[model samples]
Target: MKRLLALTLALLPTLATAGQITLILSDKIETSDGKICLYENAVKSEQVKVTASAQCRHTMTFED
Candidate 1:
């Protein structure tokens, strides 16, 4: 178990940033509109309520 734990620990960071994800927030925002918010490896929430035009973009890269 020790070796497995060590291996997992060593690879945790690499695995964490192994992929790229993009989030595109629309320019049109409204209480009835829905937006995507990502947290960690998956979406934290959906159908965000907003009241105005908003645009956002996010990108992440991994390096050894």
Candidate 2:
């Protein structure tokens, strides 16, 4: 429960930079390293909703 809260808190800041969100569920615990790819959704939403995956292009890498 605490981990979920922490993750939520961490992701909230990302929303400030953009409208939608990407809930990256990784195999490894650490989210601050390479081997991870970040992408923006091609189709955006008009109404309020949540999605799992998006038609994305290979965007920039995440840096620590």
Candidate 3:
């Protein structure tokens, strides 16, 4: 059981990055507004609950 658990834990990072999801950040939104620090810059991460929008941009990345 320990070996299996260890394997699953090790694989978690790869699985989490496998699925693609876009986190759109905006400055005008009132709810779910926050900042995400990446590299050396701090950018605002906002809530986007709508199914469709024209101003949102897609951010994508992968993990090992």
Encode model 3's per-residue lDDT on 7-59: one tens digit a residue. 99999997876754444333333234433322111433334433223333344
> In candidate 3, which residue pairs get closer than 3 Å at backbone N, Cα or C atoms, i.e. clash?
none
Cα lDDT listed for each candidate = 0.45, 0.40, 0.44
Model 1 CA deviation exceeding 4 Å by range: 21-64
Residue lDDT tens for model 2, 2-51: 99999999998786666434433322222333233333345322222223
Question: How close to the true structure is residue 29 of candidate 3, measured as C-alpha lDDT?
Answer: 34
How do all models score by TM-score?
0.31, 0.28, 0.31
Q: Model 1: how far is 50 from its true place, Å?
A: 22
Please give the distance, in angstroms, between residue 23's alpha carbon in candidate 1 and its true position after superposition.
17
In candidate 2, stretches whose alpha carbon ends up further than 4 angstroms from where it belongs are: 19-64
Top candidate on lDDT is 1
In model 1, where is the ten-residue run with the lowest total lDDT? 55-64
